[model samples]
Target: MPKLKVKKSAKKRYKLIGEKKFIRRKAFKGHLLEKKSPKQKRNLGNKVVVSYSDTKAIRKMLIC
Candidate 1:
């Protein structure tokens, strides 16, 4: 059988942690930051775990 190729886009955007958990950056921080509150900007800078609904698809892109 041929080896499966990992999705480059997913590889850059999502990170694999341990087994099935994936971490990703929050959006809305890339632009228009001047108007956003400092609290909001600080919160957006953090990495968040991928939602359960999206975990399966992300796993396929990353490992399948």
Candidate 2:
């Protein structure tokens, strides 16, 4: 059987922290920054953990 490779794109998009937790970037920070509030922009810059439901699938893609 062929070895399953971890997806490089998924590796870049999500980071494994501690053990089971995956840290990810917040969306909506790409364009039209002027229209968003300062607070909103600040909040979007933080890294957050993926939801419990998504962690299982993401783990497979990441080969964790």
Which has the greatest TM-score? 2
lDDT per model vs. reference: 0.92, 0.94
In model 1, residue pairs whose N, Cα or C atoms come closer than 3 Å (at least 3 residues apart or on different chains), thus clashing, are none
lDDT of 2 by residue, 1-64 (tens): 9999999999999998898899999999999999999999999999999999999999999887
- Lowest summed-lDDT stretch of 10 residues in model 2? 14-23
Report the lDDT tens digits of candidate 1 across residue range 1-64: 9999999999999988887788999999999999999999999999999988999999888784
TM per candidate: 0.87, 0.92
Candidate 1 — which residues are off by over 4 angstroms? none
Error of 2 at 27 (Å): 0.3
